[model samples]
Target: MAERIFIDTQSANAMIDNGSAYVIDSTLLQNENSRIKHFENRIRGAKYFSIAEIRDTSAPLSLAWPTFQQFTEAMIKIRLPNDGKAVIVYDQTGFGTAARGWAMLKYFGYPNVFILDGGLPKWVAEGRPTETGEYELNFTDPVDWRQYLVTEHHEMRVLIDTVEQIVNQKNSGDNRFAIWDPRPPNMFQAGSIPTAVNLPASTFFNADKTIKSPEEVRELLQQHGLGGEVITSCMKGINASLGYALQKYSGNDHAHIYTGSFEEWKKLKG
Candidate 1:
């Protein structure tokens, strides 16, 4: 078993005070583009923290499109002291963003990474300290992390054509084809790709935002009819990443995450 890759806000605070960590926020959940202004002043003279925003764009799923190399490059170029460990803190209900970011780091071959558990919502609710204003990032040369790339795994992606191929196989009487929808049952769009089972990503976490045990995850997979090559997706791509992590960690390597998800589906069919 690999190390537990997620932490809580208190644990994250301790890490900042003692160990090394990085803060990443997914732009999708942010109410305003100016939300970055919240952390500007507190991090002004800070030496160890680095912040970044992952842009969510509507595109076809392909590992070639958003390579792990690009993500690692951005992290490196920002030069937040690589004290051999990094942890990403997200907002309360935005668990998907931190999980997705942590998964990307692992996919790129970076070992020591973690996500701040409970996210920002829990942090504020618990009366934890927070900084305000926009944080500036100093551009610096990123270390060569090519050796840590996990982009070679074809199983990590499922594109539009892949779904078409799967549907074709199903029409040809291939019962092995299966789809796993990681959104709430209601959120599962009216017309789905073909043969997908609904398995909300929320199933993978408790109210406290910790990863469930392997047995628990396996049960959820079975309950949702997630056998064979499961294509996981949510509204966009964040929650689907959590679905991917749960499946992969539960010993299902054949699971592929559909990055475009419902967002791309509606656009293409419209």
Candidate 2:
């Protein structure tokens, strides 16, 4: 099994205490006011990052995947430590939109990245400390971002071209890869890539939105007939990122995300 990329609240707390971790508050879909309130009551030292900065702004949707240059430059804004400290990414829930940041960082070959298990809700439930203040970034010197440019595992995400190859392989009786759609049931029922399995982000989590154990997730994917490789997709791509992250948490290193999912597919291939 691939080592899990999830960190529990206790472990997260310890990392914070030891000053060996950087926490990214990747929570989106909220404004500065609401975000401020949440930040005022959030885990200490959590840095806020807009999902758009690391996206392909030219793409049809505001949430499109970032180009290599866009991603590297935008990621520099967060100023993640390259000194080997752990980096934890989380959204409103532990396993939601935050997966995009976690996934993108991993795709670029950052080794210490992790998704917080259970997220803020679980942290509060466990009675962890919360701090309030203006978020700050200490950009002592302009980083040589060239060192941090995503250098490997570009295959962590697949484009339309790659999806085409997978489709052809499937048509030729290849069963090693399974397409996964993480959209809601209603949207998924309306239309989806043929042979794609419906394994929405919700299916990989408990009622509380915290992800299930790796063992449970693996079994659930198996129940849905997913094999070794999983290609997760959705209307856009943010929601499906959580599914791809879940696959990694469950030890399927071969899992991938189709960043330009159904919408892009329809535009070019429909």
Candidate 3:
């Protein structure tokens, strides 16, 4: 697996000036237009691409990963860079959906992907330069997308079968993995996969939306005694991805995301 990369506003701005970084706005479409416009304007030359552009909308949970072919198409449509440029994904809400975008790109074999710590909100708070209007990508050939697809890592995702196996292990008292719930305390208290532990994703960020220091994140994970293979889940997979990213950021490469997560788990149980 490639090392997860994260950058502060200063580093991101430097990369942008050199034309080696491609900024992706991963904010949800339903976000207020003014908010979206403000974000776009703040990051000059940033391209807008939502998770919806690459997800399988027909899935019950809606955030399901796309098929290989579908992913290829989306990459072409989004005009992703083909020159091995680094990707910086960001959203209005800290690293929420932006983490998902980073995970997707990494799963697809893109090595230089990074998330903008604190996202657009932090950038604005820092009083960065702002420019209005949209930016366009110069489309690359669809065939180029295939060169970057890494099949082995793609299979590392935690699917329903893996979740079922985890449940079985818990029932038999032979558990080999830990499940991390990134939802709120109330949601975790109401119900979750049996034996799953609550570790709200919010704990990983500061009040200003910036992520906690690596030492702080590592200490928090250690305090929970969470180790070895761990799977992260939430109502959908958005927050879960953030958990997975946080784990990776803390140097736990074995961390994975339960893509179906709580939504699919509930459906399956019913």
Best by lDDT: 2
Q: Which tens-of-lDDT digit does each residue in 210-238 have in candidate 3? A: 88878788789867855568888877777
Tens digits of per-residue lDDT for model 2, 1-270: 756777888999999889998888777653555366556777877877667566888888757877777767666766764556778887765566788888777776777888888888888888898787776543446888555656657778888888878888888999788999977799898877666788666877777666678888888888887648889988777767877877877788788899888878877878
Quantify all predictions' global Cα lDDT against the true fold.
0.60, 0.77, 0.76
Model with the higher TM-score, candidate 1 or 3: 3
lDDT comparison, 2 vs 3, better candidate: 2
Please state the error at residue 193 of candidate 2 in Å.
Answer: 2.5
Q: Write the residue-wise lDDT of candidate 1 on 1-270 in tens digits.
A: 434555666777766766466565532334643244334322212222222333322335322235554555555555533345664545435364555665555555555666666666666677766666443455664455643334344557788788777878988888686777777787786545566677777877888776677777777787767855788776666667777767776778678877677667667754
- Between prediction 1 and prediction 2, the one with superior lDDT is 2
